[model samples]
Every structure is written in structure tokens, then in C-alpha cells.
Target: MIFLNVALKNIYMFQDAKLDLSYPRKLPSSTVENEWLEDFPKINFKRVLILSGANASGKTVFGKVLCIINNYIAGSSINQSTSWLDIKKVMFDKKKPTSFKVEFLTPKTAQAHKLAVIFDQDGLIEESYTCIDLQRNEPQSAMYKRLREFEPTSYYHKTKNNHDITNAGFTSVAVSQGKMKVPSMWNYRLCEVDNTSGSQGRITAHDTNIIKTFLSAFDSSITKVKSIAAESYKIEFSNGEHVLIDKGKLLDPDRLSRGTHEAIDIAMFYEAMKNESFGESATFYLDEMLAYSHTEAEQSILNLLIDTLPRHSQLFYSTHNYDILDMNLPVHSHVFLKKDKYSEFIQPEKMGYNQNDRSLLGYVKNDVFGTLPSMDAINNL
Candidate 1:
């Protein structure tokens, strides 16, 4: 099954995983509702913010909060879709009514909007609820019912579920259908280059062009993979042609490493984001942004996304690999999560750092953040 615009958009390697039962699922929905927002972190987010924390820290939880809020405002939701089953793996569940409240300022929407969602043991007890913190406004009210119904095809409203979006804004919500539909242009384009005899001539002329475009987003030269279908995927350039190796034979993608499977998947996902127009306002929350890349290629994948994705879109992703934090990224880009003595997932900000001195990587290295264990600790254990 395909999932559209539900999690992350554009980048393929960083897409969220579809739950297949083998993955450890979280508590039942009823237990999710008892938790409440103790407080909101006071931080000015960038066009892109990375919520980095320990294993159980609220990084994924914050991402869910944003997702629920966005889907509510855009009239596009994934509540009815099983594609979000992976979200259970990402979010923190206390087996109680859990509430999330966030005050955010979108680039277009200037008003301070308060959005909240409460998930209890009874199954999504509260969907995202929005509120406008206007001085003249009275008590909280439902915003979804008052929205302009911008996307009639959106499945969010089709479901009989009720979400609270009293203070939610326009750019805050979007919908995610279970399956994805690739645009005809991309399909035709890929097919055109499907079968040619030469290294470059075998596929459609656009084949190399597509690969070039895909690689241009990164800071490094194109990654050299022997075959898109193999474990040691390498690239060999000769006579103005790229050859993928399979069983020691110099051939095109039809014969290569298993990485080819990943390549095709990436190509399809990229087409979805490039062809779709969600206007300029969109935010994607991917549970794991590096699902297909090799350990060394993960950073390159992220760099490509950071380069190709338009500034209008915001992304939030989670990963167990400390390699993602290898570089000295900005402090604000991360939100360190750790379980406090109370066994609740809490952000480093809530734990009483100066905020200015709070470093997610540092907290993680020192083991002061999030409920989950650290990579070093995990490895050493």
C-alpha cells in the first residue's frame, strides 16, 4: 500500500516505514489519551527544525503534534488510513490520556495559534484541536467546522471522526491517503528510458538526466554504486556511460544490485513530491528519514533533501543511528528526549537547562535526555 503526503514528502530515503506487524507496536489507542501537555517549549523554530533526543524523548511526539495540527488545518488527514500504523512506533504513549499543545507562527499566518490533541485508551479520544489566541476572541471554539473546505477530495473530513482544531490555522493540517499515485509525467518519463542497449542509451535519455537531477541536490559528487540491486552498489564511469555491475557483467539497471529496488522506490517517491502542488505551505513528519540508505550514505541522503526540498516545506525525522548527529548541527535543531525519574518522556528544555546551553548531542552523550538509552550505552551494553 502507498501513503501520500502523510508522513514526509519529497525525499525517499527518509520516508516513514509502513508497519508490518513485525515492528514492535505501541500501547493501544485508549492508553494514549491520559497524557496531557505539562507545558510548551518556548523556542523560535527555523524553517526546518530537527528534534533530536534520546530514545524515548519527545522528538517523535512533537512531530506527531505538528502532523495532527497540520492535517486538521488543511482538511487533509490520515486518521482513517492504516499507513500511519507506524506512527504508533514513533510517538510516546503513557497508557493514559495524552495531550499535546503547541504555539506556533507559520510564515504566512501571523496569529499565535494553540493546537492540542488528546489520545486516550479508548482510541484517538481527541484529534487535533486548534485555537486562535486573539485578544478579542472569547473561549475556545472548533476551527475545522469553520474552515473553507479548501480540499474537497481530502479524506480527512470524509471519515466520521471528530478532531478539535479550535485555534488551528490554514497551513497547519494536510491529508495522507493510504496509497500513492505517481504522476503520469514521471511515469511516462521513466518508461521512456526503460530499455536501451548502451550503458546510457539502454534507458530513456532522461534516465541519466533524472539521476543527475537527483544527485545535484547533494554537496558531493554522485554516489558511485556498482549496481542499484547489490550490497556493494558502486558506479563505474567510462566512455561517457555509467555501468552497473551484476555477476561481474557490465550492464544497466536491468542487471545490478538490490539497491536497484531502493532506487526505483526513491524515484517514485520523488515524483510524488515534485509533481504535487500543496501550494507553498507544507510540513512532513517522517518517523525514520533514512529507511533505504546505507550507513555511510545516510548523511548524503539528508544533505540532498536539505538541498532539493523547497524552503516552504518543513521536516521532522527520528533515527536511532548516532551517525545522523555526527556533524555539529545547530543546537535549536534538536530536542533531547529522556524519561525523567517519573518515567515520563520529557524534553531537555523541560528538565531545566539554560535553553541557551542545552545541546541535544551533548545531553545524549552525557545520558541526561530522553527515556531511551543512548547509542554508546546501547552498543556497550
Candidate 2:
């Protein structure tokens, strides 16, 4: 599934915001070649998006929003009383209901699906899902809508299947009749590594190659990686040194640096994707992906993400690293989040800058995107 856009209201720092993943009508000349994935020969969509902002500017909150939406759509149970939290007393009203709307497309039919929900501290208030035929510019015959009124707690549902649903769970109704296919989605936060155990046996050449490719990108000294035990692995370096990872713990005379750990974690994830452990069409949220890496290593990992990621998947990563701003990514792929304000997409031409300039440092310094924080108060302190 490819996400087209998301709209949220009364969710944490977001009062009302929309994130659009679809490509804009105009193209930036300096955009990276083959930066977009083509759904059809004539229709293309962006696969990589970067979120940037100062500390506490809602970048991570935005990532969490995606996670919430993913969990809800995947039919994961949630606590209604505590799940819906208002921004604050000043910005929130007891009478207001939080809402979210998500728009996406399925690979099989290319139908545009819009799923929306309204809820409050008590429980779900209303929900609806509509599928639109993009080719014909009309909505499909199958649609699902639910409203809560007479019974305050129960919901009245209407669908093409004509099933009578009262007080039914939103996810249950949505997943019924095989109407919605839940996509594989994962959120990778800083330093969080998958610790699933690998059996102790002869490591296949394919596994060896995958490990080497990952380590070589950060440190060329690494020669081989083998599963030493369950949830553990041994790393062999060309310099006759060894390092052991036991259950995500690094055991070496000189402990592996955070950067190394980050690389290993990402490499293992990529290897899993290569092995088809993660099904096709997954969406990955990499929060502060470059937190532990230096400039050079960060660039290397970015290159790996661009080159090795499955063509059918999409990646949304947040970063404070300015070097990323210098990359040849398209202008539409950059999202700038502001504190207590609306997030927006950056258009280079609109800001009187050429796309090929590669002078993002200057842009931020001049407040072209308004994500940079004002340090004047710090000096006063």
C-alpha cells in the first residue's frame, strides 16, 4: 500500500495538520535521478521522505501519529480512556473530538482509500472508509460508514455487504469481508534493534554476504559475521580482532561504538527484508535514524537506504543532520515541523532558491523554512 496523505486534528502537538506524500505537479530539476517509484509507467510516487525540525518541534510526535494510525488499522486493541490525550488544557476543549483521516492506494486496484475516525476520551465517536476509483473519478460501490448517536456507546454501521453491525469495533468492521488489507509497517527508533534469535549453525554464504555488505559500509575492517548462539552473533575483523553480540549486548574489549551498533541494527533489518522476512510493501518509520552516526557514516547509511531498500516499500525518517538537506532529494520530500505551529513542505523555488544550490545551511540560517530555533533566549539565560 502507498500512502497518499494523512490529516490529524487534536493529536498532541498537532492542532490540525496534513502530510502529503504524493508528488507535486512541478518537478525540481535537481531532484535525485530515479528518486520516485513508478506505480505505472506514467504515474510515479515518492518513496523516501525526510522530517526535520529543532528539538521538541513535533518531529517524533508526528512519527508516533503514524504508529497510532498503523496500530488502529491493524486491529490492535487500544485503551480508549488513556489512548486519546489532548495537547493541553489551554489548547483542548472537553467538547471537542479528536479526529484523523488517512488516504492511501492499494497495488492491486490502484483505488484511493480514505479512512477517517473521530473519537474522544470516552471512546470512538464516528468512523468511515471510502474507496475511490481513480481512473473513473468515482467512488467504488463498496463503502463502510459508522456513527454513534442514539446509544452514545454503540455505533450504527452501513456497508455494501448489508451486514447489521451494532456497537462493533471499527477495526473488526474494517477488516471484515476482507475489505482492508493491512500493510506491514514498522517504526525503528534510535538504538532500538531487533533481537530475534538466530539459530547456531553454519551461516550461509548469503547471510555472510549480507553481513559483510552492512559492516563494510561503516568499517571495512570487518570480515565476517556468524551466529554464535541464539540472539547472539560474533564479528570477525580483518585485524585479527573479534567482537561478540549477546542478546543485543556488545561484548568486546573495546565496546562497539553507538555508530557501529546503529549500523548493525539497520543492516540486520535490511538483510531480513532481502530474505523476504518482511513482506512486500512495508512502511518504515526511522526516528532520528542518524542520531549516533558521524557525517561520513550517516551519508553512507543514507546511501544504503536509497540503494538497498525494497523498491515497493516506503521510508519516512527524521533527522537533525544538515548534511541530509544537501542531498539531491526532491523539494517535496522535505517536511519541516515547527513547534506549536503547522508543519509544511519546502518548495525551493518559492523561497527564491535554486534546487541545485545545495546551500541548505544558508537556507536554515536565513529562516527559509522556519524550522530553526531562535537562540536569543539562551543568551539571556
Candidate 3:
């Protein structure tokens, strides 16, 4: 499944906000080769999104929102709770419901699927799911809906669809077993790729080959990656040196830098993709992906993500690196989050800037986008 858009209200730093990744009605003239999905030509959809902002500007929180949505849709136990204590407290007498709506597409269905949920400090206030007929541009049908005060119902026309009401699970299993093919979702944060020695450490010969390919792209010196045993691997380098990884512990830590650990984490994702571990279509959420990496390595990884990720997959990343602004991504691919405020997309042309001029550094320096940090207080200190 491909993500189209996400809407949020009274959730953390967001207050009635919408982040639309769907292609603009009209593609910006600056769009170039390999920037968009080739199969979905009719729909203007971006496969890569970069969220950048100041230290406390909600970039990571926004990523967490997406993670929460994914978990809910996947029928994870995380969302079946009776109440939510993590909601943002309302400052005024009026309390707003913390809600979010996500829209996505399934490969087998012609309609777009939507899931919306509203909750408060006490519990879930409302939840609903519907399908929209893209061809007719109308609400096609209501799959399932539940209001806090009313009994939940699964509707098909006037009658309830018993098959749809099976309390087994929601979108996750239904999409996989049903006609629609839901997209797989993966989330990565700092240390997850480096320090965590989870299932990712287990590898097959094919997986090792795939990891080698990505590692080679990032560092050609990595001649081979071989799984010696469970949770252990051997990496041979071009300089006739070898390093061993035993149950997530790396021998000779000085040889494999933090950047390599990050790269290995990414390579494991590639291995998963090759093994069809994430399903047909996938969405990857990476937070602070460039941490501890130098400029050249960052650029190399960025290019790797751009060129290597499966065509059907979408990558959403949050970073503080200003160098990314120089990558010349289409305007629609950028989202700027302001602290305690709303997030907005930056359109290069609308701001009277040339896309090819690499003016993002200048724009941020001039505070054109308003996401830059105010360092005046630091100077005073």
C-alpha cells in the first residue's frame, strides 16, 4: 500500500494540521527523473520525504505519529488500550480530541482506504474506516465504523457485513488475507540499527549477499559479509583485514565506525526487502538517520536510499543536516516543522527561488522557511 496523506489534530505539537504527500494536482516543472513513482503516473505521489526543523520543532514527534498510525492499522496491542495518557494537555477550558486520519492505497483495490481515530485522555472517542472510489471520486463504502457512545457496526449498504465484523483483527490481517494488499511498515531510530541485536542479526546466505551489495555501495572496501553463526558474522575488507560480529558485539570496534553500523542497519532493510519480508509495498520511517556520520558518508547514504529502495516503497526521514537541503529534491518532498506550531511544505518556486540553484542553505540562513533555530539566547549565555 502507498501512503497518500496524514491529518492530525491536538496530537503532541500538531493542532489541526495535514501533511499531504500525494503529488500536487499539477507536477512542479522542476520534477526530474527518478523523483516519483513510475507506475502511478496519473497520481502525483512522492516516494521520498525529508522532514527538517530545529531541535524541538516536532520532527521526531511527527515521525512517532506515523509509527502510531502504523501500529494501530496493523492491529498491534499498543492501540487497544483503554486510555491515552500521552496526549498533549489543552491549555484552555475547552479540550480538543486527539485525532488522526491516514489515507493509503492497496495494490489490489481501485479505491483508496482511509482510517481515522479520535481519542482523549480517558479512552477512544471514535474510530472508523472507509473506502473511497478513486475512479468516481466518491465515498464508495463504509467498511467499519464505531462511535464511542454507540454500538460498533460493520456496514455493507443497509445491512451489516458479518464477514467484516469478525472481531479477530482490523486492517492488518484483513488486508493481507482479503483482496487488498496492505503496505508493510518499518520504523528505525538511532541505535536501533547499531546497538540492537534483534532478529536483524540472523541472516541467510542470500541475505548476506544482499547486505554485501549495500555495504559495498557505502564502502567498497567491504569485500564480503558472511554469517559465521547465529547472531554472528564476518566482514572481510579489501586491505586483507577481517572483523567479527558475535551476537551484536563487534570485535575490533575501531575498524567499523559508527557510520558503518548505520550503513549495516540500512543494508539489513535491503536484505528484508529482497526476502519479501515487508510485503509488496513498504514504508520506512527513519529518525536522525545521519547521526554520527560525516558529510560524505551522509551524502552516500542519501544517494543509496534514493537509488536503491524498492520502487514501491516510500522513505520518510527526519534530520538536522543542512547538507540535505542541497540535494535538490522537488519542493513537495520537503516538510518543515516549527516548534509548537504547524508544519508546512516549502515550494521552491512559490518562494521565488530557483530549484536548481541549491539555495536551500541561503533560505534557511535567511529564515525564509522559519525553521531555523534562534541562537541569540545561546550567544547571550
Residue pairs that clash (backbone atoms under 3 angstroms), model 3: 1-183, 23-44
lDDT of 3 by residue, 256-341 (tens): 77777666666665555444555545666667756767777776666666665665667777788888877767766777777644
Q: Which candidate leads the pack in TM-score?
A: 2
- Please, what are the lDDT tens digits per residue for candidate 2 over residues 60-160? 77766676676666665344334431222312345687778887665556555677776655445566666644443222222112111121221224333
lDDT of 2 at 5: 74
Ranking by TM-score: 2, 3, 1
In model 2, the runs with Cα more than 4 Å from the true position are: 26-44, 80-95, 136-172, 176-178, 190-208, 216-223, 237-241, 248-254, 273-277, 341-359
CA shift at 259, candidate 2, in angstroms? 1.3
Q: Can you tell me which runs of candidate 3 are displaced by over 4 Å? A: 25-40, 80-96, 136-183, 190-206, 209-224, 236-243, 247-255, 273-275, 340-358
* Candidate 1 structure, TM-score to reference: 0.46
Candidate 1 segments whose C-alpha is farther than 4 A from its true place: 1-43, 51-69, 76-98, 117-208, 211-276, 291-296, 339-363, 370-381
Identify the leading candidate in terms of lDDT. 2
Cα lDDT tens digits for candidate 1, 4-71: 11222111121222111000111233111211111212212333334454544444444544444344
